[model samples]
Each structure stands twice: as C-alpha cells, then as structure tokens.
Target: MSLLNSLKWKAELQAITDTVDEYDRPKEVRTKVRDIYFVEIGITAEEKYLSQQAKTNVVRRIKCRWDNTISEKTNGLLIDGVEFNITRIYVLPEVREMELSLAYVD
Candidate 1:
C-alpha cells in the first residue's frame, strides 16, 4: 500500500507479561515481541486545560500501524527509547492494517 511506503520510523511492539515477585504479588511487565521498521509514525502534543484546577496538561498522540502483530490495549510501543501506552486500536476491514492511539508515559 502507498501508505506503507511513507513509513519512516522504526519501533518495537511489546506485549504485557504477568509475573509474581518474591512476595508472590502479581506484577505486570512488558516484553518485546518484535521490531518493526519503516513504520509510519507520528507524535504530536496538544494542550488540555483543566478548568476546575486551572491546570494544563500536554497530551501526546502516537499514530502507528498494527503490522500484523497481535496487539491489545495492554500492549506498549517503544520507539527511540521512549515508551508509549496504547490508548486504543482501530482495525480496518480484512485485518490488513491498523491504527494505534497512544499516550506518552513520560
């Protein structure tokens, strides 16, 4: 597809891993599934104002592809040493492509 050709960023798709620590407490970890290169990715920031608190927060939007990988809402994407939390996933018909909505962790 022509959209795939415009992809310029490379990123790793990671899934959540459940584990128990020494105390037997449940813990969630992220493990990399694979590296996807030539991916079309874009990060943008928007200022959100909270009228009640008179505060503003910078929200970042991360757009990328599903890349045929099994991804869920719990999955995270790592790009350029930055980790993003997957907010939502939009899949197209035939499962040929997907759009990920992400928010920056930091």
Candidate 2:
C-alpha cells in the first residue's frame, strides 16, 4: 500500500514468442499484448552495479500489479517505447505488489 502517484509511466507487458529463423534456429521474440499499464520505476545503487557487472544493462526496477497473463519466463515490459527484458520478478510479501528487474534491450 504505497502511494500511487509515484507510478508515473505507462507500460506494456509483452509475451514471448519462439519462432524459427531463416537458418532454422529458434529465436525468442517479444510481442506487445493488450495488457498495457501504468507502473512505478526506480533504481537502487546496488542493483545498478550488479546489473552492470552482469552485463545486462539493467537501469531500473519496475513496480506494477500482478497479472495472470504474464510471467518472467514468457514476458517483458515496454516502457516509454523502450524495450526491456525482464530478468527477475519479485513478488512482495502481500502478493499484491510485483517488482521487476529489467534489462534494456538494444
């Protein structure tokens, strides 16, 4: 139960798709679904460094409601038209809050 005003940016949680390339190799593609939303974005000092070391280019943490339509294995977030790969999902103790660790996709 945090204040809602901090959640400023609107985003979309996208589902992952597996498709074959011209070389016949499997590639994971993310497609935006109908489930778009507003979410809170934050960045911690520790998290920033850890992501940098991991070479994931993760610049922020995103907080949003839990959606049955998405999961860490099958979805990512699109915020401000920037694509981010979801590296982890942390569900708060109350199960009402979901925090995602996002890695920028270039």
1-106: candidate 1 lDDT, tens digit per residue? 5756766677888897789999999987889888765454443333233311333222344444545555655578887898877665667656355766555664
CA RMSD per model (angstroms): 5.0, 2.6
* TM-score attained by model 1: 0.63
C-alpha TM-score for every candidate = 0.63, 0.75
- Summarize candidate 2's per-residue lDDT along 2-105 as a digit string, tens digits: 53665566787788888999999988888778655456567888888887887876777877776555676788888778888887777775656678898877
What are the per-model numbers of colliding residue pairs? 0, 0
- Where is model 2 more than 4 Å wrong at Cα? 1-8
Clashing pairs in 1: none
Model 1 stretches astray by more than 4 angstroms: 38-58, 62-69
